[model samples]
Target: MTPPPAPAAAPDPAPGWLVPGALVLRLMLVAALAVALSGSVAAWLVTRASGQEAMRRMVSQQTDEVEVVARLLASKIEQSQKVLRTVAAGITPGMLESPSSLEWLLQQGLPAVQFFDTMQVARDNGELRLSLRAGQLEKAADLDPTERDALRRTLVDGKPLVSELITGRTGEARVMFTMPLHREDGTVMGVVAGALRLQSQSLLPPSMTLPARDDSQLIVFTRDGTILSHSDPTRVLGQVRDEVGLAPVYTRWQSQAQPVVGRGMTHVQSDHIVSMAGMPLPQWIVARVSQSQALLAPLRGAQREAWWLAVASMALCMLLAVALMGWMAQPLAQLTFKARQLLKTSTRQRPETEMHWPQAGGEVGDLVRVFQGLVQQGSLQQSRKDTVVGQFQAVLDSATVGIVITRHGMLEVVSHQACVMLGYTAQELQGRPSRTVYASDADYAQVGDRVRAEVAAHGAFDGDICFLRKDGTPVWARVQGRGVRPEEVHGGTVWILEDITAAREAQVQKSWGRMHDALTQLYNRAAFDERLGQLMTERSARQRAPALEEEGGEAQGDGVVLFLDLDHFTVVNDIAGHDAGDDVLRHVARLLVSHVRQIGWAARLGGDEFAVVLPGCALARGQAVAEQLRAAVRAWEPSYQGRSFTLGVSIGLVVLDASLQDVPSVLYAADMACYDAKRAGRNRVETRHARDVSVTSSGRMALGPV
Candidate 1:
């Protein structure tokens, strides 16, 4: 039988499916390694970024502390300079010549200053004139080298000088502030000086009461490295660089053009963050130092924890990779083949073919369903996109105001109303630069910047601006707009513009009419009433204010009111026609305006009646003004239709005082005075004293005590 032809040379057993087992294991292992490496790098980057942020915050805090200390010290030095100036101004040559008188003067004045513990006055010749310490008079003597040098510098510059740290003759750490005293001829006669005691708590501001952390320090030092003040009293007046063992910091500070901040070694060989600021007035440096290691201890611990977490995640990923490698072998191979086939089919725009996946369950079935859903959803989304776009276009076209959408200030879409308002078709406006719709290049640039800034700050902007039509005519528009995404500088915006030129003109005319008379163009009764009410309210508020009370609340002594009535105004109107009467009245109004234009406001109350409010004119001066008005009326010769005659006016004067409660009371008093002047002579002046008054239910003034 030939043993079945020796098994017919059985074909080599089909290569055991190598893609299933070997390919899956290799892919999972590579993915696991990539995840582990990425986690490690990400953790390190995050830790480093957090540490940098913490360092930046610590440095900023130290900078604020140094700036605060410097400002407080400069302000204290300025206060001392002011005190020295006041003392210098009062000290005459006679007082400086007599030691006893000088000592007495200082004893009285020195008690007022809380910062300075000692004060001394010295002659230009370097002889101490007087010394006041703790409110006691002390013996005067020759000036020391520090005091003599400060005095000589002050004399040379004719300005104050703050000295460096000085050990007084009594062995106390002090800084001297000196100002020169000048004679009547501007010659230097003497020097006035004040001392800031380094050890005194009052020398520092009350707000300087900190928690007193031991590791932190504040140091005030001169440019040469001598310390003026320190948190540790023992270090006060010592050389800061030597005391703190920070020679590098000192050397860096000496050459620094601006403020400095850094981490450096301190006197104890410990790392510290140092912040330094220079004072402009006193020419000193202020520094704040804090232990860097102590500040960053928490961050270091967090870094360690982060590394451990990364390691734990890597182990978890390795376990997951091992488990996933087992099940994913067969399914991954089948899915890879199917995915490539599906992608190739999708590119051909073929009708989606139903995938004949194996009747397996779990991840394989879900993967098949996901692919089918993607194909079906893409078709549905395409159908809905057309409908939504159509609806958006409909809404945009129907907008009432001129609506526009712009990307980077270039027009993208415009509404029908926008086309009509700008005298341009949508084809002409869309895709064009927005500057085309502005009145000028400057208006486009300025208005675009302003509107963008407003939208950025407040999310919306509403303003009236000038826009140009296609015909190059300017249109006033009320523009309302909002940013689509303000935080992104390149994000576009939407604008709604309403034409408001006619409305704006009408508003202006209405506003002008409210404050002026239609005939004379002078202020009307309503304007007069509003202005007088505001003045009275201000005066009453001032009278009630505590500050005004402390200042004695003196009355405006020169305030006055002048009221006048034309004596023969009605007779002229009866003799001449009303047109001639109008001419006469206009001429009289012009005369009154010219007279009070400089010193006061003039108003026409009614027919032939006028009033003047003099803000700073006495009642006696008001009488002079009244006489001038009467003389002007008497000198005027009007020829109306072959009739020539002169007219007279009766005048009344009332002084404005705190006793008057309201404008009505003052007006009533002036009217009664004018009636008296008319009854007395019909052309003379009369005066009325302000009195307590009552108002009847008819709104008529009834003069009497309340």
Candidate 2:
């Protein structure tokens, strides 16, 4: 009555289909597991690799920053050394005799040093001199014997020595550098010493900032394990500790001459240590990066969330695989047909392919939405091209450069900037040939040839050219031009011009100033040489002229060279500033110009020196003219700063004939005569004929006139 053992289930159709179906389901499950495992493994491996790479990059960047800081420190050290050398050079034996010179050296030299606490000059005779911001102070006596001996050692070596950290009179911790002062013959004269404070900020990198963590620190120590400077000045300065944990690291750095980087596990205070050596100075700079609760707090939370998300993702992938397998088991032929149909539709139009993903509230639906958004974006791009082009045009027009367009050597279109720079209206410039603005036909042709050559060689031209303005004045412009087809140009060749007249003028003036003295604004040495050559050639030609013989003269054109030097010019320059001296020079130039206007060339040679060249003037006539110039300068009085000052000029005259071919020799003779006039007395004129001078041991001259 138990229901006859529930009718032993009938052995239905062949089990082959069911076996393959079950096998397919198991295979699908294994494949999904494999994919998820592979993905997770790949993600973890990539993350680890990325983290290691990031760590290496961070370390490399830190090392580079450290190197930069070290280089800056080395520069400061070099600067200090130069300053010490300069101070030593300024203290000479002559300087010691003059107290004012000593004071001037202290006032000028001390302020010039960039990073110094004090400057002291100590003589070998136990005399100590100190310069500070307040004023100069002389010590009561020489320093103690020990200090004097130490200084003498530094002086004998002629090298700078870094001293141990010691407190100054101002109660500031500082280190001193002593450099020796040597004579021209390499004899030790004195010692020049400079002090630098050893505060936390003194030696530290200007860009360095203390880490936010309270336990983090930046420590700087000498090579011999002595603390020099630290982020916490109060804690490290003048306090020497064993620094046991850091000694080995320091030794490794010294041997390798490189940075040491590692994590300090047991120290609780510092979890990471980075140390490097400073160049030129025997010092080790170390930065300690510590582990802080505040920094690690948020990381723990992020790690927890990352683990949960990874696990959830793996489970979700497995469930999706199982569902997909189950659905595929029902109808393989239908799925294949559907996939082929979708592919064919997608080939013809992309819009239809967007609907291929399942859109019925699942992961596949979200992916389908993303793909659809991408297709929509692609459809919208073409509509924005015109706007972008308009913006580009706006940027071009707003640029400050002047733009001009030319076609076949004729102006086509000119921008507003071009009209403003060239002093031409836009309408006036249009359709005009380039020659209308270029001033000269020769210049226009030269420009055209250069343009063609530039385009042939380099495809463009960039340089400065002078252009004529509408008013017939020249304007300098930095111009760049390129050749283009008529169609590409919208008519012509395009050019950009930048007005650089002011800068060009400034450069020219600077070059002029270098060759000529500022006060006299005269020919200077270089200009005099050029003018003298021209005069010599003219005199040579004139000597062969037939008119000289016809006139029954000496048959030789006479040339006179006179050298004029201002006496008491220094007194004027010292009493009045250089501005007043310039005024006097201008007045003297005008006087010389007026006197030599008839038959000669006059030039202010340089400073208070002047020169004159007269053709067809006899020796007597030249002496008379020289005397007149001397009288003018002697009688002149100039008022400066509400005071009147009288000055005189000394003149040296030399007459040259056709036979004398030595120009420099004549000039030297004239200069020597002027020197003699200066030595004889002020306000006198001396004349030396070229034929009458002879070489003698005494160099005694036979004077002809007063």
Candidate 3:
């Protein structure tokens, strides 16, 4: 019948390549990413700091430019104030009373002082009596209220005062420097003032020398945030706070006790630098407003270059990862192929010479060396296996005993003696079940169980067992064996079988001779002593017998010993020689055997003297057995050498019991009774019971029972 199909196995999971391949790739990528991220962050920090430094430098440079412009303007105002004071020292009340003389004095003095837009000498009522315009003398007019207040302050303090920025009649921003004119007696007289036009390019530094960018500006504003003049002409004269971007900066500058330098917003940048310095005169603030982005342009360029370099590094990492993957996989693939080929070659019966495989350096080279070692080891092992097998076979054949190796209860290898002993060729025994050599299933199972037990306890076995030869005759074999490993005898068991058939038969014959007589082939006297002693020992021990119980009650001892003496057996030896005497002894032995067969043990003590022991028998039964043996001997007729003679036996019987000390005592009692029977009549039988009063350790004769 076809076997049932096996259950389908679950599919194996897919080979796990992601971990090995992706691990290298991911490691490289992660390292590169970490480096890139760190580099980018570091570059950003460096660039940000550089940008701030650039801004600081720019602010410093711009502030210096604004300060230079303010100083120039302040110097011009101071020089005009000094010139007015000197002219005032010359002008007396007389010069003030004559407008013509005052005009002439102002024109001559103002012409000597540069940067004076207009020069005037005014009375205490703030009316300019005479003035110089563009270096020409003109009639003076009353000053406006703002100009009067500044002239009044100048007269009251008797010192020079710088006026707030004002618009000229021509729509230009200007500042006036005013001083009180004093009389020779130290009395305040009129005011001398000069106005400098700030809008005129000459009042400010040259545009080319300014550090401010196109998007930047330099402005001079009042403490109240009023615009005075700006580098950008369009923003000149406008309120500083009116420009929304500059409001906060203007407020901060106004509150500051010293020059303020910080970032602020402007039209160009929401956050730009505003550096403010307070001018000495008019308390005006000179501020340099610079765009932050414009100042950091160089830093940005450097940052862009850093980002491009990072991108290039990432591309290089990709190329290296690809190259490393191939470099790693190729050597392993070659090693795998070579290893497989080596395995295939190693399995063949006759392998070729050692393989020379491809090699690489480093760890791959070490692996190649290991593979070479393995191949060489395999070759050495093969050669060793061949030598070992040859040596094993030589050892097996040389052994005196037959050795057989069995696997799974089948003979795998058989020695020459084993084959010869079984009367079969080596091929016939190989692969055959070990049971095939057993005489019977019982013998096979019996030997197997015993051998297994021996092997389990000692790793070896030895015993005698019966086996069948090829001709179906049984042979006694002495077997010794051992297993290769515990509980794995089925894997391999080495057995040595020595045929002991002839030796066993000889042993049996030797044993038979030691206990039996050569003349009658009956048990000898020594055997009789042994048998009778054993029987008496059993009877004394009270061993019960079923037969004796069924027949009648057992005496204290239930064994019987009989002694028989041949009647007139000397007459045959005298007439027909010792050969005829041997014939008579043989006839008597057979007669005793026929009468007492299976009843008990019988043995010939010596020439013409014999004894029998009946176990579990009462005295009455032993007496009846002795009479039968006497009658059989009397009835026997022997004819030897054509001569006829009749022979009879004198018999004596004794019952074995507790009173008998041992076999020797029983024999003495029976021997004495036999002599009594011979004395009374040669062929008659006499009986003695074990409890007879005369029987004792010291005496042999017993007349009657107790």
Candidate 4:
């Protein structure tokens, strides 16, 4: 039958894979997944950190490069100022008085002005005293206002000064550095100035920028977003906001209030790494911009390699996890196999070598030992179970009597002896009706009813009952039974049966033997006396007898007792040493029985004495039978062991009538008559009636316990 489905509220079963596979496989899978997940996360963190670090280093390097370029520009301005001061030191008040002498001195000093575009001595009125241009001394009619401003600023502060970008006399962008020409008393005589042109590469260092072939650019721009220097000469002097790479950087600097005192990396534009450093005096910015991909190329390569290494490590760790899980699960597998094998085997005691268990020392090993102990305990229990079953069977086999157990009138168990008794096999008896062994249905019902009633009352029943054997013969049995649960209406009953048919027959034969004499096979004295008492009781009860069927059809008379004494029996005993006496007595008993065998029965009262009972004989007929018994006894010639002897019998007869109250009264009259005959003369017949009181005087011969 199919089972009902589980309720919806019940928890679902585990996945299909969990039931059959080895534990190690599952553990290994989990471990591998953990390793892979952890490795992926760790690799991501490391790669991201590597990228950030590379960007940091790239930004720092870019800042340093820009700063160095800015420093180069400042150094060039300082060199120009040094030249102006040198020229001012060479001037004196006397040399400045004459243009010819000043020209001569200027021509001599011009040799050292190779780093400058022009060197000139200016007057207090801002007129050029003398000038050196292209290695020649010349005089200019109009000086550039930037140079005049430097001269005036230098004379006023008594210190050298450098001017910002200005149009020089040559109509080119230039910066002029001027120094005060002082007198001996510290009065300013005039100013000496040097101008450096900015239209060419003279102001830039040879290696002032990164390689132009790359996408990286270096620009020196003012904090107000004007490009002072750039890798593209045409882009120089252009607005920084208009440059694609510099647009966001300029905007960022503007947002920070254009402070010219910091350097850092910032993401002003996507895909770009820009570093900026402040320049002196001009508030100019030396900014470097590079595509992030290019700037971080080495770091990316390292990250790729690191990621590959992480993947390889994850694989190696998973492999180790699988190996370790397999190693750990080995003991559990053995224990499982051992537990399963126990079911497939029949015998309790398996060979020691049949199973090999792990001896590891953790919980799994302890579990293995526990399983072993259970298996050993099971084996012991199995052994004990087999022994108990065997002992029970042996007890049944040797019981030697029928043992039948019935449950609800059905044979549930039949022992070997029970089978033998019923001539059926145990298998044939089992499950069969209990009535099959009974002589009849009534007998079966009787046994059942008795068992139910008696067992409930006293727990047991015993009686002799007839059971049918296989051949349908009745077998009398002494059946003893008990109920297992008599309070239940149809409870089981156990019966033990012993065959008593032979015993009953033997008892009957013993009863017959007790009533007869062994020697003559006649009724013994006690039996004869009992028969006389019955007849006497019948007479005293005044009961009449029906007419006897006879040859003459004569009316039947009252019963008569004939008592005989064997005469000369002592003479034979004295002559034949009692052997002859016994022969004589047997001979006489045979004679008496033979004479009365047709009408009555004979009994030996004791030694040398005999009696006959004629149930319907008259007194005359009894005397006549007595006389015939005396003649037969007198005719007897006895012999013993070949010696010859003769014996005679004296007879007395008495009528049994209502006058005789009991058996002893009848026996007494008969014995007295027999004594009278023996006293009158041996071998004579004497008759006495029940009313013949004169014939009584004899010693009391009482009957026994009868």
Candidate 5:
């Protein structure tokens, strides 16, 4: 009747339910999302950059590793050269007049390893004078036109030459190292050559020719692109372009003109990483081809870690955001619930027991504030980027080795150690061409010719280099260089230099010590066996050759073995102590060496026992050498502590002929003869011509040659 009281004032329409709680929840969620996104993106960016740096270092290391392998292979090749040089140096004009003597000389100096299948000496007129194979002297084979030409070139060049690969009748690939024999005036009188079996473990290590991966391959080739060695035997002595993975690299390297001392890598293809190094000694190039995945394995793991870090940051932020929203909107949510309950009824209100209000403290900040944080975060990111760049430029600053960065040929950055090493201030070196540090123009040109190209292709270049300091002192450094970007060396290259002059000299000494005795300065037992065994094996193999039989070659052996025991060595050791014994032994070694100069190798077979291997010696000659040595020992009147001591030697000689089975039998027969000499009389000579012969109780030779 009162017109429904104006429709009950429409209950004031409930103020349209503003819903502040949901607004608070929405604002909190947005702020949380922004925070999570910013934090996650920042973490991801930081980690990704770090990951990229790590990848660069890892790839550089792999390239360095390949370079190391190349050097090791080069050392192995150098070993053969050293053996050949030993042979050439031991040649005398007197020995060359007698073909048998020269052949015996070759057998004595030949390497015992399976490195050389055949060794020979030829006159400058192309006459083959001496040929020894498998430890035995034999007739030289007729030289083909190609080999004859190579020999002529060797004589003309007056230098060592590594011949191109040759295929033997047995289908085996081999190479020849021709070392020129020089007179005092440096004339190339003749050539001493050793035939290299390409697959010989001594010439090429098993590790280099056998790759662990099927998709990978390693090869040794000449500057002309002729493959000298290969992981696959069938590919040895083939063309470089035949391998599918290496064709592009070969072409590119050829286009650039082959360098004799440089390293490089190629990745024109996506799947392969081809690294190569050229050796200075043999003019050979060592190339390693591997799958890209092998180099990128670390990069993938790093990227995954970055992604995980970003995801974890995002999840953590979202959890914090949900908690904030719940805490900040709890009171408002309750108030909204009560208001809706009241709206459902017609009654206005009894007084509520509790009141709730929304809190704004934990809610999202205003847009301006959010943007201000973003601006600061951007500045922080810039600062972080600068710090990262500085760290990169200063990496390994405290290391003793010098580190430098170069663009083109100019120095861009250098570690403190590099400044000290070059004897230049940082200000003096920056932006200067590295050419200033090289000892010679040739060295600088060599670096320019190969280092840049190699770094661009292979990522790294490593070798020993000589540099000139600011004070003009020459410095020998082992340098290892890698590109900042392997795909593009123009970006920059980093080099590490270590002083290695002392180490290099020490290495040479160490190598010498490996084969010589500390006390006698002569070949050790192992070295003696190596030389003696070569002679024995040469004889054995030649005896088995049908050609020798067909040619009516005599089966008589050319080597003579001698066994000598000091008659009164124990008296010296007991009366004057070991010092006198040592002196006497050294004197005896000198006499032995003098007697066999340029003809035989002498070794200390152990305590108080001495042996000699006389190549080209008959039984009569062997006996003469033994008597001379016995008389020399008997004449040695050594005085120790003002007391003169008398020393004598019992000598035994065994003619090492083709009839003997092996070195052991010859050595035992010689030993028995020496025992018989001692039992028969003091300071005398005894000779054994056959293994079947023995010493009777009366010290008389028995069981003569059948």
Candidate 6:
């Protein structure tokens, strides 16, 4: 009846077996999780290490490249200096002493070196007596006195000296290097100087290639903190100090003999480290490398792989979940395949998918609902990207100023305003070489050469260039160009051209107005002084050219300068209003212009003072012109507001000879002649022949005053 005691209560159903099985499943899950986590962590560590190594390699390579460039630049500069010294040493002491011989020497020496823009020889007395053949003898007065003194000191000290960047006659930055000229007896004779344009061809190589990175910048500076060359020389030249946040790095590099690398404290968001190398000329070549997100190409690929792996693991988990439900696996597999197909299709074409659930499904329906939400989000993101691109295009098209885009030297896009400014339809400019439509042949060639050179030297170029319009007239444009590979560009370089002709013209006119007199529209005293220096140079040069015999048996190589002053002009202004005085001035200026137009240049020196520059004119012709000017002024009648007035001119003429060396002496002689004319009597003409010689004025001759 016990019935085996109910099988002894089934031995408590072996609770130990159930517990051990559960524990075994839990341990497998934990082991798998630990293996996955460890794999992920190890992969992350490897990726981090690889990234660091790659960066280090890149930095080292960039540093080496920078050093090579610095050495090349230093070698070029040194070679140029040596060539100039050789030329200077060849000149004899007699050649250095004589203006004509020195000019001859320069004419022969300058063209030998391609980099020299102007070669000059001057005495210790600050007289620029000679210039090279390619030189324009204009505005010798532009030379700074301090610079001249420095050159003179170098010559006296028997040494070479390089000057800081200075502006030349053409308003371009140039570096002047001077060498001393010595006699056989070791006496200082003169100084030979060569002016090199920083933009000259030999300073840079024909081409340069940048690494596959965008956020890196390169800068070159002289030992004295002078930016000798740069990718954008115009922007960086003469802009001293670390104002652009590169100063601390530059200072540290210049102060230290070894290379220094550190993060820029001023710009923290940018993980920028500066590496600098030095050249023989005391220049510190610097390269700044920033840890840009775009440079993380390997990391980006790893992240994409990680994401896909996660997606695959999630899909497998979902499949396992469905299998546990005891439903027909085929239908669920079909549903999953359909969802995957829809996702793939949406990714390939457009992010819009219509997903439906099978009728025999509970889990299938839930899976479809989740996938549908993902599709909706993908569609929303696509729409946002499309909208942003469209808005950007619209803004660019509707901009106010003319915008032109060029790729690989060919025009790609032209805004409406750009089309109008260039006098071309957009279609006409499309696919055509930018030079074909806008730049002249010579200018285009120059620009093309410059572009190539810049790409080789600095990897980019940005500045103003004069572009010819469709009408064949030149228009100033701010042209900015950067080198790009196929990935950066649609496949070519990105060049931007902006019409800045109006602004440039305005600036030119403003500068002209500042340098000219308002009343007479003539050069003011400052301009006059400048011209006087140039005229003196011409006078000296003319005295050296082959002499020509005139029909009257006279040599006519000498130049005469006449400085004239109006007699009793203040009295006329007191009697008649300034308006009438202006009329009188106008009449006098007309007379002077008409009388001296053929043989001389006339400028209104100031109120009641005028200067007449008679080139290649002898003392007799100068005196005759002065007499005619006096007669014309005396006979002239100025009418203003129904009133008439008359004025007379007193002329003081100074004839410069081969002996005259300084401008001040000629000016003093003319001023002395003017004083003599005034003291003798008003309305008379006087001439001073030489520095100490005085002239007798014609007696007070009167034509009735109005």
TM-scores vs. true structure, each candidate: 0.42, 0.37, 0.39, 0.43, 0.41, 0.37
Worst ten-residue run, lDDT, model 2? 260-269
Count of residue pairs whose backbone atoms collide, per candidate: 1, 3, 1, 0, 11, 2
How many Å off is the CA of 28 in candidate 2? 5.5
- Residue-level lDDT of model 2, residues 602-684, one tens digit each, is 76666687888787777778888889989888889998889999899888887776545555656667777787788889678
Q: Candidate 3, which segments miss by more than 4 Å at Cα? A: 1-26, 92-94, 113-115, 123-129, 135-142, 168-172, 183-187, 201-213, 252-269, 294-302, 317-706
The all-Cα superposition gives candidate 6 an RMSD in Å to the true structure of: 34.7
Model 3 gets an lDDT of 0.72
Give the whole-model CA lDDT for all candidates, comma-separated: 0.74, 0.64, 0.72, 0.73, 0.73, 0.65
Off by over 4 Å in 5: 1-29, 39-47, 50-54, 108-115, 135-141, 168-170, 207-211, 262-269, 294-313, 325-706
Query: Judged by TM-score relative to the true structure, which candidate is superior, 2 or 4?
Result: 4
Model 2 lDDT, residue 380, Cα = 66
- Which candidate leads the pack in lDDT? 1
Give one digit per residue, the lDDT tens place, for model 5 in 1-706.
Answer: 3333222323234343344554676777788888777877787787778756764664576567667767886787678788778778888877777876776666654453235777777887778777656656755564444555667788888888877666756566667778898888877789887787677777664566654667677788877778877778767778988777788888887898866675745353577767777777667788777776666677778778877877887888788877766776666655555444444443433332222322333222223232343566666798899999778756657778998889877998888888888799888998998888987777798767677676556667887887889999877788898778777848888889998877777776877777776777777766776778888887777667868666865544477988878887888888899988888888888999999965687987777777899986777777777788888888879999889988888887888765566556666788888888999987888887774664333444322211
Which of candidates 5 and 6 reaches a greater TM-score? 5
Give one digit per residue, the lDDT tens place, for model 6 in 1-706.
Answer: 4333222111122121111222234444565566566656766776678777766776676667666766666677788789788877778867755766556555544455434776777766657766552465434665655456657778668788766666645666666778888777877778887777666665543233233345555666555666655545354564436525456655665577544322211222245545556654423344443454545666678766875786566556545544443233344444544454444434222344654435434434546554666677877898999999688657666877666667767887677777777788878887898777645576677778887777667777778888767888778877776745733634566556678898999898978876676777666666666777887886665556545333336666467877778887886788777877887777777787888766777777677888888877878878888898888888877665666766777778888786556556666677778878888987889987774553223322211112
Superpose all Cα atoms of candidate 2 onto the true structure and report the RMSD in Å to 1 decimal. Answer: 29.4
* lDDT per residue as tens, model 4, 271-357: 777777775665667778788877667777888889899999999999998877776666566555444444334233334534588
Q: Rank the candidates by TM-score, best first.
A: 4, 1, 5, 3, 2, 6
lDDT of 2: 0.64
Clashing pairs in 6: 207-456, 208-456
